[model samples]
Target: MSFSVNKTIAQINERIRKGKAVVLNAEEMTEAVKRMGKEKAAREVDVVTTGTFSPMCSSGMLFNTGQPGPQTIKTAKVWLNNVPAYAGIAAVDAYLGATEPSEDDPLNKVYPGQFKYGGGHVIEDLLAGRSINLKAQAYGTDCYPSKLQERVVSLADLPYAQLLNPRNCYQNYNAAINTTKRIIYTYMGPLKPNMQNVNYATAGKLSPLLNDPLFRTIGLGTKIFLGGGVGWVLGAGTQHVAKPQRTERGLPLSAAGTLMLKGDMKGMNSRYIRGLSFLGYGCTIAVGVAIPIPILNEEIAWFTGVDDSDILMPVKDYGRDYPNCDFKTIQHLNFADLKSGEVEIMGNKVPSVPLTSYAMSLECANTLKSWIEKGDFLLTEAQEAIPAG
Candidate 1:
């Protein structure tokens, strides 16, 4: 017997409101497809949610400190907890990026994971309701007489706070290994000499972009779970390669698509928005993000059913290729091999570790599923599709 099934976002939202929508995480969706076949699974499962948590350097927050008076100040410079924030906006608005280092950081003396405080830490402290030292400087003007100001403020003190990340949730990333005789530090973490270990990031089968490879379900204005709060997709992220080399299964072999996201920081949880510092590298934020895929057709079901073994990743040497901006594909491997503890490289087996947290990803997926099941979350049609390559 042949099966033909199709659904719409409106239909799914109605089913969710009536407490009849069948939702599953990406992992469960993969199994359901395998057991019942693609067409049947597509007809039965209304949604497949995915999640990922990892160090994303292209993340930051924008906030506005309430003006004390009309003649208080027109800010020309700003710092939060001694970390410099971009004050090019309105009088009291600033943007603190995740990779921005502390003003007191001695860059030359910094080592891997040694430099602790940065923009990421500041953001975390604010989210936890901790007071931060706020300072600003400006030349006195006719309407704003104050030249400088200093105070202690928490998240509540700020009239507005929004997390606006330019790039997050990389579709797929490279697995890094060092081919040199000395240890090297990179955004992927420290790689030992001569390929002793390899590092990669992604939630594997549970990654959002991996589930929606063609950018069909997730697009501009689509709602998502971000840092334990609700968020929306702004647009295509910086360095977004819409069309990259792919396998027959439509999985990219290297870094491909990305996302631009924004959310209200007041509602974010600190656990899902963490600060991280790498030895010999810089500081960044580890963000937890999740997206729900509405199964509108059989094709989307097949895309979400991809397993770890079926997806491929390009192996690159961080010590040489990465530092030189050379994207040389040293080898090709799969997440199944990496997660199994080790992978073979040049006739030698090397231990592999994932920088991305699969456990946290699973937790996020379950959280989103619960929200949908409780009728607290509803699907939205994308106002505009993300640009496809």
Candidate 2:
């Protein structure tokens, strides 16, 4: 990411000066010069071509093409080098300050009448195939059956006999019971099923009855029930209550439950959760690129060895077309001007070409030059750089 302005310029100058010069036969000097011009053109083209391909050399390549202004080149270089660090810093900040609730925080609400613990249980049940039902209650409506009615109704109107039913009686017997036996169900309800005293005893036994061959074929989970169909059932005598499982859509819970579930908690229990973090890492990098920042954009272009054509094109359009036009394209166009001691981009001094089109030209030039220098007209030095597959 670091760059020395003086060092870069010096290296460029030295390369140009040290490059071998062509000597031609006197009889064909015209032809030789033409050939030399073509060769030089080709060499210059090669430099332009490879420069475009060179990672972190976008600004350098652009200069060879005579397109970008000095300011644009400078700005691009600065931009490219700074993006990764900026993104890294931002990522660290986000990772440290992510404010969502932790897995164990019971207060974190996911969905109405749904607690994080319950959501996890639901996931586990879905995996293990123990009977699971999620009853979604409309707010302010009587969703709980009559068993929970008493909990919602005022106890002041309850008769002594009705309040003192032995099965429902409690320490605050009179106050606790009501005309009806319904209970108050909140979004934060526990994962355990709510049932009347009579229902509770029978509900536990239902699991065993459901193990019958007739019921075993249908899946006994929340999704199956909500979707209005029976699904495959788990084997009878499955002692363990199901635990939560991870999926792409996230924890199968209400909104409140989702909030209560922690990313770290998933990391601890599931291998799938670990993979999510890696996926997030890649997403974070992509987000960093999408964020608007001038220097960072340039830095990306430099690292990729591509021009910030989106930014550079307007600047290049104002420049005039030159005779040897191959080099004056893309980010390289600007760099070409810089090498010629034109510190300023004035009027129409820059060159304009389609980003893709210019890239091809630079690529051809570099390929030709590489072939001449490396004695392989068909293969580029870059191609040679690659190890045999």
Which candidate comes out best when scored by TM-score? Answer: 1
lDDT of 2 by residue, 4-25 (tens): 2112223323343455322111
List the RMSD of every prediction in angstroms: 2.1, 35.0
Query: Which residue pairs show backbone clashes in model 1?
Result: 111-280, 112-279, 112-280, 113-278, 113-279
Encode model 1's per-residue lDDT on 1-389: one tens digit a residue. Answer: 23377789999999999999999999999999899888888999999999998999999999897786645887889999888999889788889999888877765355434566789989999988899999988888887788888889999999999999999999999999999999997889999998999998989999999998989889998999999999999989999998898887788888999999999999899989998888768788999998999999888999999999988888999998888989899888888998888999878899998999999999889889999999999998898888666
State which candidate has the highest lDDT: 1
